[model samples]
Target: MLSYTGGFVLLAALLHASWNAMLHGNRDRFLSMTWMSIAMAAVSSVAVIALPLPADAAWPCIVASGLVHIVYNVSLVRSYKRGDLAQAYPIARGSSPMLVTLGAALFAHEAIGPLHAFGIVLISGGIMALALQGRHVSRSSALAAFVTGVTIAVYTVIDGIGVRASNGQALAYTAWMFMFYWLMPLLFVTMRGLPALWAPLRDAPMAIGSSVVGGLVSIAAYGIVIWAMQSGAMGAVSALRETSVVFAALIGRVFLRETVSAKRWLACVVVAAGAVCLGM
Candidate 1:
């Protein structure tokens, strides 16, 4: 079951990286993110109707996670705006596992075996290696990315506990969480008025299509991660999920045409070794 969960999370990591790459490649990331949220909210709205509601006990988690997710999204956009995907993404994603491990131990009482601890350390170290191998990233971008990672850790722990408290209603919890959290982005876009919202769509119709696709991919990726946490340790699952940094590095090189150093490729190998340790 642990191996199965690891594989599923690896898939989620790929999807997560793909969506972030799409967002990073866009001309107007904030606008694209707004549209992506609108798409997620639309799909989640339907799911919320079809599924049973999450337990009342889970409501607090959902609300808190929702607010943190807003911070995550905002910081992510700022991070991407300030730095290359390879640089910002690794710092943002790589910093989270250790934090999640600590948070899980403190808040959720999750025990970390020696192997899990080693894997988490390796993954985190390798990810930081990928980011720090090149010193081109601005301090501001690194800071924003680190803030994004902090939010990721906080929400991962929150949702991990919340899902367990949901009486096996993981899907319901996920649906409701997405529905609730994305509304903030939707509200932000709306407040900007119709013209501002429509400008991206009118100027670049392709942005709408990409945003819709990115939104679906994003929803699927996170939904899978949340579901996996229902059975897996939050820290282990988080460390495994952040293998997305490796994929993000590759995506940045291939799609975004960013320069990737040979040392960064070595970092990818280190990350892969860590993933193997976790899978074991």
Candidate 2:
């Protein structure tokens, strides 16, 4: 990976964490997510218009990515509703990088050394450790989070590949994917028994403000990762991007007053250490 691209990817992670914290802090996650998605679509559409469409080979992947992202957003909002951001964020983000690494190894034939293998295991362990709730979590909450984890893993791997396959047209694909991805969510919110879908917009100014901020952060995050994929290895970019989980945990603790146990802190350290090893 190019040093510049890696740096941008890290910045993207920070932005991603910030937006996630905001969503977690919100009184209505579904409303925030819906607005965020709309904002993402609008911003991405405008930015992507400056570039040409991706190659034919990228379209299928782009479409598939969009579909997966819809599921990801739904799962994420549900996870946030059920669990603390610190705990749920770690598990959801922790699961992805390892899955991306495995995908790269199996399909892209990237050679994995013992250190890399060990890093993946440590990351996964750390994530699973964070999954345990404070013993007050309901069984249904646990189940929903687990299902969310699966969706996260699936979407992360798919997007990693999709970005890589964009072949230097990462921005175009991101724009298209973000635009297309909102379709399902929009349809669901409008048609799926939610008469209150428009309720959040009753406060147009606040709605617009939150949507714009959330969307801009999201656009920056996705764009930087796409650019990173163009110049760097997908697995490495994905792994580095997953660092946002740790950042989110800190944000949650400080801002959201979300509790973090010593074990969870240690887990975060382990994941960071693994990332360091991978970086070296």
Candidate 3:
């Protein structure tokens, strides 16, 4: 079961990195993120219709998770704007699992075995190394990325509890959360005027395509994490999911044309080892 969960979360990590790369590569990241949210909400709407409504207990979590995700999106855009993907992405993603581990123990009464705890430490350390080993990232970007990481941990714990409260309808909880989370981002984008918001889509075919595909990838990635959390320890699942930083580093070098040093590649190797520990 642990191996299966680890494998799925690793897949989610790859998908998560791919979408982040797409967002980082776009000209107007905020607008691109808005479009991606719309696509996610649209795709999730179908799942919402098909799945049973999450139990009443899950609604509060769904709403809370949605609000937190808004902060996450805004912070991520700010972080990406201020720094390179390889740096900002690792910091934003790497800082979360530790927070999630503590939050899970405190709020959800989830116990972490010694091996799992070690794994979380390794993953977090490796991720931080990826950020620190490369060219220096600005303080503002690092701050924004840290804020983004906090939001990720918050929503992750919320969704973890929420999925269990979903009365065996984890899919329903995930779908509803995704569907409503876009409302604020959509409104924020619309305030800039429809013309401004739609300009990227109108002018850049690649932008529009990436936005749509990113949305799908984002949803799938998160859905897998949520599903894994249903039966797996939230902390372990979170630690595994955040291995996305490794993929993000690779994507940064290859696609985004960013610099990744040998030390950072070594950091990626450490993260993979951490993932192996979790899978044990």
Q: Which of 2 and 3 is ahead in TM-score?
A: 3
lDDT of 3 by residue, 8-119 (tens): 8889999999999999999888888888898888888888888888899999999999888888888898899888888888778877877888899999998777886787
Best-matching candidate per TM-score: 1
Give the candidates in order of lDDT, highest first: 3, 1, 2
Give the per-residue lDDT of model 1 (tens digit) for 1-280. 4777788899999999999999999987877888888888888889988998888999999888877887788788889998888888887887787788889999999877787678777877786676566678666777888898899999999999999988889888988888765665666667676688877667789977898899899999999999999988888788788888789989999988999888877777677667556545
Q: Which is superior by lDDT, 1 or 3?
A: 3
With a 3 Å backbone cut-off (N, CA, C), the pairs that clash in candidate 2 are: none
Query: Which stretches in model 2 have alpha-carbon errors above 4 Å?
Result: 137-143, 191-195, 204-208
Superposing all C-alpha atoms, what RMSD in Å does each candidate have to the true structure? Answer: 1.9, 2.4, 1.9
In order, what lDDT does every prediction score?
0.83, 0.73, 0.83
Which scores better on TM-score, 1 or 2?
A: 1
Residue 155 of model 2, lDDT score: 57
- In terms of TM-score, how similar is model 2 to the real structure? 0.89
Winner on lDDT between 1 and 2 is 1
- What's the C-alpha lDDT at position 255 in model 1? 88
